[model samples]
Target chain A: MSQTRDELCWMTISEAAPLIKRRELSPVELTQAHLDRADAVDDRVKAFVTRIDDKAMAAARAAESEIASGHYRGPLHGIPVSLKDFYDTAGVRTTAMSKIFADRVPDEDCTVAASLKGAGTVLLGKVSMSEFGLRGHPTSLFSIPNNPWNLNRSCGQSSSGSAASLAAGVSMGSFGSDSGGSLRNPAHSVGIVGLKPTFGRVSRYGVIPCSHSMDTTGPMARSVADIAALLQATAGHDPHDPYSSKEPVPDYSANLNDGIKGLRIGVPRDYFFNKDGGADPETLDLAEQAIDVLEGLGAQVKEVTIPSVADVRASQGVIMISEAFAYHRQFLRDRHDEYGPVKFRFMLGALYTAEDYLQAQLLRSRICREVAEVFEQVDIIATPSMPRPASVQGDMGHPFSSLGGLNFLVVFNATGHPAISVPCGFTGEGMPVGLQLAARPFQEAALLTAANAYQQSTDWHTKHPVL
Target chain B: MAEHPLPSHDELDARLKGAGIQLSNEELEFFRGAYPEFLDQLKLLYSYDVTGEAYPFDVALFQEPQ
Candidate 1:
C-alpha cells in the first residue's frame, strides 16, 4: 500500500526483487498491478494474444506463499513475464501468430518456458508475434502490437508483443526469440532492451522454428539489468536441445554496474550507417551519439569493418527462407491457403537452389571468422539496432518486405554472437531508437555490463511510454 | 558467382509450379519482384572466395570463450 500501483508496474525486476525479498512488496500485489495495467492498456497495445488473468493470479499466490515460507527463489522469483507466443506453453494454444497453429495447444512447456516457471515466474500468458517470426503475415490471427509510445506507430515484429508489453508497462520483463533481430528490432522499436544471447546459450528446444541454425531464445525487458536477470534464470545447458551450450553460466549481474572504463568498442559504420542501406539519418545520429557516450565511459571506439557484411541480409534471407520452407514444406503443400503473407516470404526459399543454402552456410562461417578477428581487437561491436525509429502502423505498408537490403542485424544471427539493444534516445518525432552492442561468443556478461553502464548514464530507459 | 541471369517472371512462375507450389496472382507478383534480390544475395556469397573445397564446421556458432 505504501508504493502506488504505478510504481509496481514500472519497477524493474532488479529494483523490485530486494523489496519482495524483504516482504515490502508482495508478489500478489505486484502481479495484480501488472494485470490491472494490462487490462487498462492491452487493447490499444495489443501485446497479449492470451491474457490468463486467473492463472496468473493463482501463480502469484503460490509465489507469495513460497516466499513467505522463507523460500526465496532469487531475482526472478516473483516476476510477471510473458513469452512470445512462439514458445510452446503447456495447455496453452501456442499459436506462432499464424492461423496454421491457431488451434494447436501444446501438452508440454518448451525448455525456456519450463525453466522460467521453475524459477517461480508468474506466466502472464503468451504474447503476439509474426507468423513463424518471418515478418507480418497478411492473414495472421492476432492484432499486431502497437507502439505504446504512439498508438499510430507499430511495435516491430516477430517479437512485437514481447516488446510492446514491456514498453506499455503491462509486463515487467519477458523472453522473446531472435532470428535475424526479431527481438532486438522490436526492443529498439518500442524503447526497451533485448538480448540475443549466443546461439546456443539459451535452449531452443520448444520454440516454433524460424531457422533452426539461427533461432535463439533471448530475454526482453525495460532495462538491461532486468534482461540480465531473465537471462540468468533460463540460460545454461539443456539436454533436450542438442545445440544447447555446456559452457558455464556466468553470474550476469555480478559485473553489471562494473562500468566499461577501459573496454574497447568497435564501430562498423560503413555497413550499418550507409544511407543507401536503409539507415535513417536521425537513427544513425542517435547511434553515433550513443557510441560517443561509450567512448566517454573510457571505451576506445574505432571504426572497423566486417568483410562481406553488407550483403548478410541476402545470406540471412536465403538461409531463413530455405529452412523455413523446409519446415513448412508439408504445410505449404497441404494447407497452402492457411499461411498468411509470411507464407509468401517463407515459400521464397523454394526458389533458391540447394547450392544457395550451402553457400549461405559457408558465408556464415566466414562471418564468424571475421567477427572473431574484430573481437580480438575490441570487446564489443556497436551499431544501431534498427535502421530507424517506429513507423506509423499504416505506414508499414504491406506485410511483405525485401530481405536483401543492407541489414546490420541478421549478421549476428549468422555469426552467433551475443547482442543487446539498449534504449539510446528518441527521435525528433518522439519515437525511440536503440543502440545495439554485440560481444564475442559466450560473452553475454560483457554485453550486459556495457549496456547497463549506458542505461545508468542516460535517462532514456526512465522515460516510459505514456499509454 | 557465375553470371546467372535473373530468372524471367514466366521462368519463376514455372519454377514455383515445378516445385508443386501454387500462388495467387498477387503472391506471384510479390515473389517475382523479390526473387531477383534473393538471387542477388546468393550471388554475394559466391562472389567471395571464402568457401574452400571442404566447408569446415564452424564451432564459433556454438559456445566460444570470450
Candidate 2:
C-alpha cells in the first residue's frame, strides 16, 4: 500500500525498514517527508536545536545506493533518527542546551552516534534538552520545547525536544540519556516509549556526563518495536567506556511476540499510591487499569512490597548531585555564571561532606540488594512513570515540587536495572499517562517482550497528538 | 540514627568559597530555598543506621588505571 506524506512521517522504523530494503520506499523520500513535517510543525513543537537536512539527504542517498547495490545492512538502514544534544557528534554542534557548550563542536562522534551511523541510520540533527539535563533555567540559550498534545503543557525536561520531535513525527526515533528519568519522563509526557537500559549496558563514551554512576544512554521512539530496533543497534560494550558491561547483548527484537503469559508482574502500591499530596489520582487510576489489562492478557499480577523504594528518591538526589558536583567543579570555578538553573543545584553538592555522600552511597548499596531480593520473587516491577502527567510549560523547576513524594522511576536508576516506559492511558483532559515496567539487570529482551505485548493489546501507543 | 542538620547560609557560603565558587545574592537566596528540601532528603538517607554495614571506600577502585 502507498503511504501518504503524513503516514510516511509517522511510520515506525519497524514498518519502514523492510520497505526501504525492498526499494519499495526511498530513504530520500522518507527523510524529506520528515524534514517537511518539521518545517511545517516544529514552530509549534519547538523540538530540534539543529536540523542537518543537507547531510541527512546525503546519508539517505548513500543508503539508497547501498541497498540498490545489494549491500543492505540491517533494520536501521535508512531510518531517520534524532540524537539528544548531549551526544557528541563529530562535525555538528553538541550543546547539551548550555551556553558553555553552545558553540562547542566535537572532533569525533560519540560511541552511540558512531554505531547508529554504522547501522546506516540517517542523522536528522541535534535536538534540545534542559540545560545540562538538570532543568531549564530562565537564562538558557535555547527555548524549551512545548508538548505536542497541548501547546500549553510541557514535553518534559532534558529529553524534552526528543520527545516532542517523535510525538509530532518530526523524527521517527531518538537516542537520549537518563541520569534520573531524562528520557522516560519526556516519553511519559509525550505519549511515546523510552527505555533506560541497565546502567552499564550501553556505553556513555563521549556523551556529556551528568551523574557518572547513574547516567545511562537508551532508545526512545513512538512504539516499543521501534525502541527494540534502536536498542539492538546501540546496546553493546565499548572499550572506550571500561565501565560498560562485558555481558553479551541480546537481540532485543528476537522475542517481541513471546507473550507475557504467566509472567509475574509486581505492583508496589503503598509507596506509589500516595494520597495526601503524592501521585495524582488520575495517574494512579490509569496505571492500575493498565495492570488489570496485563492480568487479562494472562500475566500473573500481585501487590509486592519494596519498602526501601520510599528512601531511594532521597538517596538518588543526594548521590546524583554530589557526583555531578565533581564533574562541574572546574566549570563552576571558571564559568560559574554560565551554568543554568543547575547552578544552584550543583552548588548544593558543595555543602555535602564526604561523609554525607558516602553514607548515601552505602544506603544505595543496601537498597540495591533489597530491590534485587524482591526481583527473586517476581519477574517485573510495575509503576506509574511519574506522579502526574505533563506539567504546564514554564512551571517546571530544578528541584521539582513533587520531590518530597515518592518517585517510581528513580529506584531502578539506583539499582542499575533496565526500565521501559510505555504509554498506558490518558487523563480525563486527554493528557497521556505511562506505565513503567522494569526487569532484572540486562534483561532488556524480557522488558521489550512485555512492553511490546502491552502495546499490541492496546491503542494507547497508536494515538497521536493533533498539532 | 542521628539527625543531620542543615547548614546556615554563612556556613554554606563559606563552603562554596572553599570550593572556589561564589554565588550572587539572588543565587544564594535560591540555594537557601532549595537547601532545606535537599537536607530533608538527606535526613531520610542518613536515618538508616549502617553501623556494621561495610561498603567499599577504597579510592583505587575509582582512580585512573595505571
Candidate 3:
C-alpha cells in the first residue's frame, strides 16, 4: 500500500486494520490523514456538525500507544469514524441537527457509541442529520450537506451527512439511523454501502428517537467489507434497551469472500421494477444489471412478491409520524417556534386517531408476516434502493412520484428485516444507483454474504466521488 | 361502510390544540398544506380492513431469534 496521505484517508477499514494491528501503520498518522482531508474537503460537503479535532487526536494517540504495547483491541482499534448527531456521546453535545436540542448534551454514551469506543475506534465527532430525522423539513438550524458526487443535487436524508462524509473520504466508517430509509436512501444517493441491521440487532439506548418501532442504527461505508468490520464492532445486545434482541452476535467480516454459490436471490418485479413502482428506466436497468451480476456468481434468481407494499408504505408513514409525535408532543406544544419546518411533520401526527395508530400497527404485523413468507422461499430479496437518482434541492416531488422512491426502502423498516444498499451502477449522469438486498430478521449474515459476493464481482463500490 | 368524512379545518385545528399544539397562522398554513397527504395515507391503511388480534409490535418483538 502507498503511504500517500490522500490514499490513507480513503483506505477502507479492512485495509487499514491489519496494517495498524501489525505496527506497519501508525494510528496517529491514519487518523491525522483523515482529519486533514476532512479539514480540506468537509467545507464542500458540510458533513460534520461538531468535529472534535483535539479529542480525536488525543484518542488516536492513545490507540497508538496501546497497539505499540501489543494490545491491539480489534479491527476498529485506532480507526477513525463519525457518529450521526443523534447518538449521545457523554459530555458532548448531541443535537439531531435541530435547534430544539441545540444545547443538549448527555451524561452517558449510547450503547453503540460505547461499543465502538470499547472496540478502540477513534471518534471523529458528530455529523449532521435531518431536523430530528424527519423528512420534508427545511434544514434551517444546520448546513445542508452536499453530495460529494454532485454538489448541486441533494444528498438524500436524514442520514445525509453520514453518507456524504463517507463519499467525501472524510471518515472511513459512519453509523446512522434509519427509520424510513434514512441510511439506505443516502447510501443509494451517494454510492456507498449502507446496512440497516435487524431492528433489534443493534441497541438504540441513547440515540434520539424518531419512530421507536421503525428506527434502527447501522453502518455505512465504502464497501461490504468495511461495513462488516464496522458492524462486527458495534453490533450485539445491550441490556439497557428493552427492544434490543438477545440474539447472539456473529462475526460479519468472517465470510466476505465465501461467494454466493447456490444461494437463492429473489427479485420482486411487481412493486420494485414495474412502471408504477420502479425507478426510472435507466435506474431500473442498472438494478437489473446488478441482478445479472448476482446470477453470474452462481446464485439462483427468481421472482417473488411481498404482499401489500402500498399498504405497508402508507402504514409506515402513519406509524412513524405518530410515534415521533408521541416523543416530541411536549416540545411541539411549548417550543413550537424553536423547531425547524419539521413541526409540520410532528403536528400531522396529532390528526391520527388512536385507532389509526393501532390500524397501522396491525398492518405492520400483516406486512411482516407477508415478508416472512417470501423469505421462506427466497434467501434474499434485491431491489432498487431508490427508483431514481439524487433529486436536486427544492425539486423532490411527492414520495409517490416513482416506484423505488422512499417506498421500497421503508418496507423493511415496517417489517423489521435487515436490509442493505450496495452501489450497483451509475446513471449516465454519473449519479450512483444502489441495489438493496434484505433478508429475514437476524439473517444479516446471509444478506451481507450475498452483498459481499456481488460487490466482489463488481467495481461499482470502488468508484468514489471526485471531490 | 359509512363514509369516513374528512375533518374540517376547524376540526383539525381543534384536534391539534387538544394535543397541546397550537400553530401560528404561518405554521397553520404549513400544516394545512402537509396534513392532507398524511390523512390520505391513514385512509389507505384503513382501506385494508385488517381483522382479528392486531399485535402492534415489530416482527422481532415477541419472537426469539432462531
Candidate 4:
C-alpha cells in the first residue's frame, strides 16, 4: 500500500530506514513528500528560517542513487532532518535568528552538521532559534512558530522551530543546542523526545555558544529510538572541539529496547517536587504516575535527594550569563540597539561582578559533587521537564521574572549528565508535560534505554497534535 | 549581601555606561526599572554558602576518563 504524503511526512527515522534500505521507499520520494507537507503547513507553523528546497531535493536524489546501488549509510542515511539556525552551515547564512549575523554565511559546517551530512541525511534547512540561544526574540524574528497543539501557546524556546516542525510533521528529526533547557523545553512543550547527551558527548565545533561551560548539542525527534539513532550518528570525539570527550562512543540504538527492568530509579520526590514553588499540581501528578509505570515494569523506584536544588538554578544563571556576555561582548559593544529586550536583560551579564561569576562556579562544583553521590545510589534520576506546559505565546511576563523556568532541567546541564525528556502525559488543556530522565555522565545508553522503555509502556510519545 | 537587596538604578546605569556600552534613553530607562528584580534573582546565588570550593572547569569533575 502506498502511504499518503501525510503518512510519509510523519514517519520516524527508525520507521523509514528499513524501507529505504529495502528499496520499498525511495529516498527522493520520501524527501519530496516531506517537502510538500512542509510547504503546506510551514506557513501556519513558521518553523523554518530558510528552506533549502533545491539543495534538499538534490541530496535526496543522491541518497536514492546510493541506496539503489546497494549502498546504505545507516538509519539517518536518508532521513529528512534540519538544524537550529545557530549551527553554522557551510555556504548557508547562519544567523542564529538574529539580524546581527543576518548577512553572514559560514564557509564551514559545525562538526555536528557536517557529521549528519556525512551520514547522508538530507539537509532540509536551518530551523529558527532564540538569538544565540538566548537574549533575542522569544520566537524567531522570521516568524513566531505556533504550537501545533494550541496555536496561541509557545512551542518552547531556543529550539522552538525544531519542536514545532517535528510536531507539525514539517521535518522528521532535527538538532538543537541546550545550555539551559533549550532542547528538552521545546521537546516537552511539543510532546516529542529530546536528549541532551553529556556535555562533551557531541562536539560544539561550529554551533554558536550561549555558555561555553554548559552548552550541549543534542537531538530532537518524535521517538526515543529516533533520538537514539541521531545520537548514535553524532556522538564522538572531535579534534576541532577542544571540549569534545575522548570517551568511546557506545551504540545507542542496539540497547534501546533492552528495557528498564531491575534498574534503580530515583524520584527526587521532596526536592524536585517542591523545589522553587514546584510544578503545577497536575504536572506533578503526571510525573508521579509515570514513575508508577516504571515500577510496574520491574524498575525499583526510590526517593533520593541531591542537596542544593535551588542553588542549581541560581548558579546556572550566573555562569551562563557571564559566559554569554564574554561571547557577545563585542556585539553588545558595537550593536547594542540591534538586540531585543530579552537580550538587553541577559547582556546585563556586564553588570555581574567577577567575584559573583566565580562564586557561582564554585557553587556549581559543590552541587556537581553532591549530585554525583546521589547517582552512586541510583541508576537513573527522573523529574518533570518543566513546571508547566507551554505558556501563551509572547507572554514572557516581566523582564526580571524568576529564572524558575530552568528549575527542573538545569541541574543536569550543571552536572554535565546525559538527560532525555519523554512525553509523560498532557495537561487538562491538552498541552504536554515531559518526564525527564538523567543518567550518570556519559551513560546515555542507560538513559535512552530507560526512556525508550517508558515510551513503549506509554502512548504519550505517539500522540500527535492535530493542526 | 542581604537576602534580597535592591540594586540602585543610578548605580546600575552608570555601570553599564562605564563598560562602554551605549543604550538608548528608553533602554536605559527600562534597565533602571528592571534592575531590582534582576538583582533579587541574582542574590539567590549568595545564599548558597559556597565557601572554599573551586570553580567547576571540566566534566571530569564527576567521572573518570574511560
Candidate 5:
C-alpha cells in the first residue's frame, strides 16, 4: 500500500470506501489520516470552524468494530465527511456564523447529518460559512475560511468552508446548501464538484434557512462519483420536513458511467452565453470546450433561447431578500450588531414592500413556466458556472457585488431546478473555471448522469488545486 | 431593451420613510440615488407573465413524519 501522504489524502470517497469494506484500511486509520491532514492544513485554510476529533475517532472505532463483527452499514461506512455550519448537529454547536446564534446548539441532528451518520460516515467537523449563510464572500463577522488555491482569494460562497476543506483534502466530501449560487460559486472558485439537488430531494429539516423556498442541501466532493455516493447516502424523503417530497430516490452511482450518447443538451446561447459583456472570454472558451466534449460523446447539442433570464434573476433576488428578511427580522431588530455589515444592511434595507414581494412571487411563477418550456425541448442546459475566474480578495469587489445588475445563479434558484457546477478548465493564472448544468425539477438523476459522462470524457475534474 | 419608468430619488426616499425604515440623512440620499437603478433592474421581472402558478418558496422544518 502506498504510504505517501498525497496518495492517502487525495483519494476520493469512491476509492476509500472499497478499501475500508475490504478491511484493507481500518476506519480508525482512515479517520486519523484525515485528522492529521486537517491539523497540518487547517490553520492556513481555516476550513473547519469546529473540530470534533474525539467524537470522530470514537465513531471510527465503532465502525471498525461493527465491520469486524460482520455488520457492514454501507458505502459511507468509514468515509470521512464534513458538515456545513448551517446543519444542526445534536449537542454540537451549529452556529450559522452569526453571533446572534453563536451559542445555539440544536437538540437534534439535521436530516442530512443524521442520514449520513446512520449510513456509518464519520463527521470530521463543522465547516465555516458566510454569516447565516446570508452573503457570498468570506467577510463574515465570524472567522472567514480562506480559499486554498490562493490564500487571499475569495472562495465564492456561503459554502466557503466546504469548498476550501474539500480542496485542502480535509474531508473526502462535505455538505453545502445553495440559495443563490452558494454551492455552485464556491465549487467554481475552488475547483470541486457541488450539486444543488432538486429542492425537495434532500430534506432540509434542521438546516438553517436562507431562502425558505430556494435553500437546497447537497454534496460537495472532488469527483462526480464521490458526490453521487454522498448524495445516495444523504437523499430521501422525511416526514418531518413539510416540503420533503415522496419522490423516489434513484441509485446515483449505478448509472453514473452511462455514456452521454444520444442525449440532447441545449445551449442557451442568448441568455447565458451571448448576453452582452456577460462571461469572461476564458469562461466562455471553457464552456464551449465542454460543449465540444459533450458533442464528441454523441450528444446532440443545439442553441436554444431562454427567454428573460435577467427577469428570473430579479424575481429571485426579490423573493430571496424578502424571505431572508422575514426569517431574520427579529434577529435584525434585536441583535442588530450581531450580523455582518453586508448581510445586515442588505437584508434590512431590501425588505420588499408587500406589493413588491407579492409581485416577485407572481413573477417567479412565470419564470419557472418559461424555463419549464425550455426544459421540454432539452434534457439539460449547460453554461459557464460563473461569469469570471476567482479573484484575489482585494482585487475583486464584494462577492455579492452585481455584474451589470445580474446575479448569475439566482435564476435557477427561482425556478427550483437541480443544477451543478463541475470544474471544466483553468484560467491563465491556474484558477479553476466551472461549467454548470441544469435539469428540470426532480431530474437530478439525468443531470448527474450527464455530468458523470462529461467527467469520464475529460480530465478537468481530476485536477486539484495545489495547496 | 424596453424602457421602463422608475421612481425618482425623492420619491424613493419618501417611500422608505413611509415604509418605516429609519435611515440617516446620508443613508437616505445614498439609497435614494441607488433606488432608480435598483427599481429599474427589479422591474425586469415584470417582463415575464407569471401570474397564477404557485411560487416555489415553501420551507421544511423537520425530516420526520409530522
Candidate 6:
C-alpha cells in the first residue's frame, strides 16, 4: 500500500510500530513520505521554524539498516518526531521564538530529547513557539506558527508549532511543554492529543525555563495510544532535574484497553461550568455530553465545587511572572534591544517587590492544600479545554481580550495536576473543541488510562485537521 | 487589603530603571496598558489567608542516582 493511503499519518504509534517491525514498510520510505507532505504544506502553514531534512533522512536510513540486521528498538524506533524550540539540541539553535536567544545554541540534547533519541526516533527539527513562551497573541512580531486548519486563526501559544506541525503532517509526533496552557491550548486549536503529564512525570532538565513551578514536558500526537507509547519512552527520573519525581514509572501502554468502569468523575459546577463569560454554549454542551458518555461507560459522574481556583489562578500568575522575570533579568538588561516587544514588556513587569513574590507563594500553598482536598473526593475532574475554539485570524489587537475568559486549563497548571486535552467535537465552523481531563498530582497513569478508554470508545482523537 | 492598583507608567518605568532595565517610550506605553490587567489578576493572590504555610507550587521529581 502507498504510504499516504496506509493511514500512517493518522495511525497510533502502537499500530505503526508493528508494521515496521514486520518489515512491511521501511522507515526510510515512511520518513520520506512525511517529509514530502511537510514540504508541500509547510510554506503555507509555517509549522516548522527549522527543518533538518538531511539529518532526518540519514537517521531513517540508519533505522532501516538496523532493522534489516535484526536489531529492533521499541515502539518509537524509526518514528519521525520534532521538538519545540525550547528543547536543547546539540549544535542546533534552540531559540524560544525570542531574538534574545536568536544566536544561542546548546551543546547537548535536553533530557527528554535525549530519551526520544535513545528510543531511536528521527529528529525532524525545531518547531516554532512564543517568544520565551510569554503571554501574547501568538502572532507577535516574534515567530507565530499558523494554525493548519485556518491560517489566520491562532494555533494557541508556547507549544504553537508542535500542534501545527502535527496537524499539518510535518511529523508523526512532537514534544510540547506546558507551563500554563501552552500544550493544551494548541492541541485544542489544532485537534490533536496533548498530554501534560504529572508535574514530575517527565524531566525538565535543559528545557528553557518559563516557570519552574508549573513547567512540564509531554507528548502531542494524533491518538492517546501514541501518547502512551511516547510517554513510556520519556517518563523517568533524571538526577539532573531536582524537581524530577522519584516515583516508579508505570507501563502506560501495557493495559490501555482497561475501560473506565466504576471510576468517579467530578464536574466542577460553579467554577468550571458556571455561566462565566468564558465558555461558549456549544463548548459547554460538548463537555456535558462527554460526562454523559463517561456515565454510560459505568463511571459515576457528579458535580463538585472547587472554591479555591480563583486564588490558585491568581497565585500562579504572580509566581510565574516573578520567576520568569528573575530568569530573564540579565538578558533584559544587556540585550533589551533584541527582544520582541511582547516578551520584553512582559518580563519588565516582573520587576515587582520581593514581598509580592513571597505573598504569591504563600497564596500558592493555600490553594494547593485546597486542591488536594478536592482530589480526595473524586478520581478525576473534567472541564472544557478552552471556553471556545481558536479566535478568528488577524484579531490580535489586544491579545488577552482575544482570549476572553478561558482560564480553565491554567488553573490545573497552578495546582500541578496531570492534565490531558482530547478532542470532544468540532464547532459549526469546523474548528475543534477539546475536553480537558485532570487527575491529582502524580496520577498520570490513571489519567492516561481514562483518556485511553475514552479514545477507544470514540473516534474524536482519530480525526485530523485537513490542511 | 484594599485593592492595589497597578503603578502608573512612570512608576513602572522608574521601577524597571531601579532594576537596571530600560524600556523605550513605545514599549513603556504598551506595558502601561497591559500591566494593569496583569497586576489586577495577580493581586487576587493577596486575597487569600495563607499565614505560615509553605507554597506547594514547586516541581517535585522522583530522582535516582545515575
Q: What is the C-alpha lDDT of each candidate?
A: 0.84, 0.86, 0.85, 0.84, 0.79, 0.78
- Candidate 1 TM-score, C-alpha based: 0.96
How many backbone collisions does model 4 have? 1
* Residue-level lDDT tens digits of model 2 in A258-296: 999999998888887665656799998888888898888
- Per-prediction CA RMSD (Å): 2.0, 3.0, 2.1, 2.1, 3.5, 2.6
* Residue-wise C-alpha lDDT for candidate 4, range A1-467, written one tens digit per residue: 39998999888888999998898988888889988988888888888999899999999999999988978998888889989998999988888877778888999999999999989999999898777786224532566688899998888887888998899998889999889888999999989999999988899999888899999999999999999889988999898987788788888888888887899999888766874575688888898899899999989998998878766877888888889988888888898666665667566788888788887888898888888888889999989888888888888676656454446888988878889999999999999989999988889999988998899999988887787
DockQ, all models: 0.46, 0.36, 0.57, 0.52, 0.30, 0.46
What tens digits encode model 5's per-residue C-alpha lDDT throughout A1-467? 54566667788888888888888878888888899989888898888988899999999999999998988888899888899999999988999887777888899999999999999999999999877776644344457777887888878768989999898888989999998889999999998999998888899999999888788899999998888888898788888887777777788888788888888898887766754766687788888899999899999999887676756767777777778877776665455555665443354334357667777888777667677777789998998898887767645444334523545677788877889999998888788888999987677878988998988888877776666
* Candidate 3 clash pair list: A277-A403, A279-A387
**Best candidate according to DockQ:** 3
Q: List residue ranges in candidate 2 displaced over 4 A.
A: A397-403, B52-66
Residue pairs with colliding backbones in model 1 are: A138-A341
Compute fnat per model. Answer: 0.45, 0.47, 0.68, 0.55, 0.34, 0.53
Per-residue lDDT for A22 in model 5? 84
Residue A304 CA displacement from its true place in model 4, Å: 0.9
- How many residue pairs collide in each prediction? 1, 0, 2, 1, 9, 9
For all predicted structures, in order, the TM-scores are 0.96, 0.96, 0.96, 0.96, 0.92, 0.94
TM-score of 5: 0.92
What is the CAPRI rating of model 3's predicted complex?
Answer: medium
Give the C-alpha miss distance for residue A324 in model 4, angstroms: 0.5
Docking class of 6: acceptable
Higher DockQ: candidate 1 or 2? 1
